[model samples]
Target chain A: MAEQSITSKPQSLKSSYWKAISAIVWKDLVAELRSRESISAMLVFSLLVILIFNFALELDIGTRRTVTAGVLWSTFAFAGTLGLNRSMAVEKERDCLDGLLLSPVDRSAIYFGKAISNLTFMLIMEVIVLPIYSVLYNINLFNPGLLLVILLGSIGYTAVGTLLASMAVQTRTRDLMLPILLFPVVLPILIAAVKASSGFLSGANINDIFPWLRLLIAYDVIFIALAFMVFDYVVEE
Target chain B: MKTKPRTLIALDILALILLGVSSYLALVFAPTEATMGQVQRIFYFHVATAWVGMLGFIAAGISGIIFLVTRNLKWDRVEVASVEISLVFFFITIVLGSIWARPIWNTWWTWDPRLTTATITELIYIAYFMLRQGIEDPDRRARFGAIYTLIGSVSVPITFMSIRLYRTIHPVVIGTQSAEAQGGFNMTSDMRFAFFFALISFTIIFVDLFWNRIRLGALADKVELLKLKVMQ
Candidate 1:
């Protein structure tokens, strides 16, 4: 029976493949928009982090200049972790992940869909935090280069974050496992992102900032390809 | 049990002899560095341990691939043995490096590339154990362990590259390049021979220990199955 299906209708394969991807993405987005539970939790968690950083780092005028990028990015990174862990845990809890796996969809499609949804939640929280941070610190963080850095950093961050979180959620200490499993591996990305963003914000030359951007891009491409290829192993029952 | 496995007993005696000779060559035979005198001797074992650690890492990664291909538990045992020994040896390497660094670099730690990679690789192995701990089923544990090791092996190099780039932009004081060029004396021919020989000797020791540990794992699995059957 499986062999007969393989022999028949190979052309329909390409279209249904994409159809599966969009369906998964659409499912996550619609569910998120209706419930707003994941985004709201992430958004609130990010604000609390900024608030704590403001007081903890003594985000004074001078300190803010140095720490603004670090504080903001770390906040997003931490809260983005919350969203990723919950995102996977929710699917696993609802048995939706199993259903998705059982469907005719390609496994990579599920990876992309979850990654895209996770990236969206992270970006939304970052977007909200940016304006509040700018208004609070009175530091303009709206620069194009800085925005580019954020996008590249988040892409790389979410690419690996989703993969690791999927593994973590299956573990006994699901929620606690993500950060422990993640921070060490992704240290390079966070370090480069903060440095590059700070450099751009401080009006450093493009030459000074370009290498970091290159690192971020390289990380994003490598891990994205890695996650795509290895998604099969991770999600297989 | 078959009478103590003559080959392993032979390997053990050989390893001990080589290790003793290597230590003597490193400490007494090799001439001391003019700048950093006694601490430099630690480099012989430090580099040797690091080399063995790398060997274990490669073994674990290959075992991971083999496990996935064959879906066999024996390769999983090989993977765990490699990771555990690699973890221990890498810890020794890192500490010995620190001890050597203190008198030589005047700091206990420097984010040198090899040192940083050592730390990251240690973390990777620790995570490997943690992932295995989380699963109850042996098969699933083995699968996840193999997959994580494969992913980690690929990522660790990229991690090293990024850190190296960071180091280039901000070269720490007492890094290997400048320290060797400035303060470190040239290695005598005897020292060079001992150094490479120490690496080869440790490689053999690592293989012997790895075989023993894999046997231990197999015994543990046997006991676990027996316990399960008795409970039933």
Candidate 2:
């Protein structure tokens, strides 16, 4: 009876830890669903970025073959920043962050919760953008490899982005702070993602694309661990 | 306020003398290269300043971690001092590299991995200062600053590796030269002497500047405290 009680204690703690994470995620999702603020902004902003790139790059057939990946990744990067800034700023503006912090849960649970929600928002935007991009450019971007790269890239981007966004919202220039702090750090993800996407779209050798996939996965793992370790420092009052 | 320490004063003078001697050794003592000629003289100072920049980069990253662990304001001062010194030295290295490249590579710039990584590192530090500027609380500013530096340091090495997927044309001086590397040259015994001397001298200079900067940071902290007291 004593052994069973001791073993069961850790099991319950583990479940409750996950419960805290999902609770925060559920709160964000429900709030976002009702408001539609972050998603609408990210979607419309990304579409505009694509339109601007069309005129700017003169994406004719030949250029499109080479630059489609670049254009798409750049659009996502800009729109990701917009969504990240809004997500954190909404918390700060209404004092939701303080209440969240006051709850009896580990701080890293907050980090994962925010990161997962940010990743979801970014994935939704990518889903909408990919089809529109394919239809307009007359290029099929539906390869399994391409989707894998997008998912991995968004995970790395949002993992770091969510951490930085939390810091940015507390600053005086909250809106301007996110991109300045984020772009240089996330350059690796953009480079690897663009390379892998282009390779898949161009029907290049699988061997050539595997290295970039490795880099994207490695980046996602390193940054998620780093952010989890240091998040407590960022949020401590 | 405390007076400047006697040791720092003496070390500053020694640094000045070493700088002059290192310049003399590099410009007059080292032989002219057959391929690059006099423009190759920039290599000595360029390499030395880049070494100093790298030293500060490591120092800032380590100090940032220590500051986060210790939660001590003194480590914050050390982090900021090293970052400032590194920022200036890296800019000098970039300009000097450009001057050498124009005559050698026939262009002002190319998107080589090292060159791009250096520029990106510079931008990251600039953004660090901008982040610090936006926060009013000193403790919060230091915390964010340390976190950002930690992030920048980790990301920079990965950035270099990712960019290395592309071919690099920058010359490999220390290691065996790749077949495709441009402007590669063999250093004579005298040139090695000058290069080593320059590296040592620049390291001393980096230490001197770092100490002075930390003292300045300490002074600034004192002023902030006094002002707060007056307000109360």
Candidate 3:
């Protein structure tokens, strides 16, 4: 009876921790669905970026082969900052963050919750962007490898972006502050993602693409852990 | 106001003298290279300032971690000083590199991995200051600053590695020479002397500047406290 009680206690605690994380994620999703603020802005901004690159790079047939990956990744990165800023800004403006903090779950649960939601928003943006890019540019971006790279890249990007966005919204400059703080630190994700995407698009050797994929995975793991460890300090009163 | 420490004053004088001597060694004493001629002298100061910059980068990363872990404001000050010093020194390194590259690489700039990484690192710290400036509370500023610095330091090396996947034309002086490396040269005895002397002198100068910056930060903190007291 004693052994069963001790074992059951940890299992229940584990389940509750997960429940708290899911609850926070659910809250953000439902709020975003009603408002459609972040996703809509991000989507429109990403399309504009692609349109600008159209004239800016003059994405001709020859150049498009080399630059499609770069153009797509750049759009996503810019749109990403928008979503990250808006998501965290909503929390700060509405005092939702404080309420979340006041709850009895672990601080990292808040970090994971916010990061996952941010990742979800970014992935949605990417999914919409890719199809439009493919149709507009007459290029096929439907490769499984490209999708995998996009997934890994978004995870790393949002992991760091969410953490930085939380800090940025508290600052005086607010939205302006997020990109400055995020871009330089997030360069690894951008570099690796662009390279791997280009390699897949160009039909480069699998072995060549593997290094960047590994880098993306490593970055995602390292930053998620770092964010978890430091989220407590970032949100403390 | 408190007076500057005597040791610091002595160190300042020492740094100035060393800087003067190192300049002489690099310009006059060192032999002009066969390939690059007189422009190669910039390498001495270039490598030295980059070394100092790297030292500060490491120091800032360590102090930032310490600040986050201990929640002590002292380490925050140290981290800021390190970032500021590294930022300036790295700018000097980039400019000097550009000057040398013009005559050697035949272009004012190329998108080499090292050059790109240095510029991005500079941007990261500039963003660090912006982040700190936007915050009103000192504790929160320090916390955010430390966290950003930690993130910047880790990302920079990885950024370097990812870019390095592309071919680099930047000369690797201390490492195995790649055939494609432009403006590569073997150091003569005298050149080596100037190089090592410049490194040592710049390190001393870095220490002096860092100490002074930390002192300035402390005084700024004191003034903030006094102002708060007056307001009360």
The candidate that achieves the highest lDDT relative to the unseen native structure = 2
TM values, all candidates: 0.92, 0.97, 0.96
Q: What shift in Å separates residue A56 of candidate 3 from its native position after superposition?
A: 1.2
Q: Which segments of model 2 are wrong by more than 4 Å?
A: A1-11
For model 2, residues A55-151, the per-residue Cα lDDT tens digits are 9999999999999999999999999999899889888877999998999889999999899999999999999999999999999999999999999
lDDT of 3 by residue, A1-237 (tens): 423432354456777787778777888899999999999999999999999999999999999999999999999999999999988888887698899899988999998989899999999989998999999989999999999999999999999999999999888999999989999999999999999999999999999999999999999999998999899989999
Query: Which candidate tops DockQ?
Result: 3
Q: Candidates sorted by TM-score, descending order? A: 2, 3, 1
Model 3, span B36-59: residue lDDT tens: 899999999999999999999999
Winner of 1 and 3 under DockQ = 3
In candidate 1, list every pair of residues with a backbone clash.
none
Candidate 2 has an lDDT of: 0.93
Superposed Cα deviation of residue A195, candidate 1 (Å): 2.5
Q: Per-residue CA lDDT of candidate 1, range B148-208, in tens?
A: 8887787788778776665432122223544232235567788787788888889888988
Q: How does residue B200 of candidate 2 score in lDDT? A: 99
DockQ, structure candidate 1: 0.49
Instruction: Looking at model 1, give its docking quality level.
Output: medium
On residues A1-237, what C-alpha lDDT tens digit does candidate 1 reach at each position?
433443355557786676666676777888899999998999889989988987788888988898888998899888988899988998989787899899877899899989988888888888888988899889999999888998999999999999998888888878888887787778778878998999999999999888888889888998899789778878888
Model 1: runs farther than 4 Å from truth?
A: A1-11, B1-4, B168-183
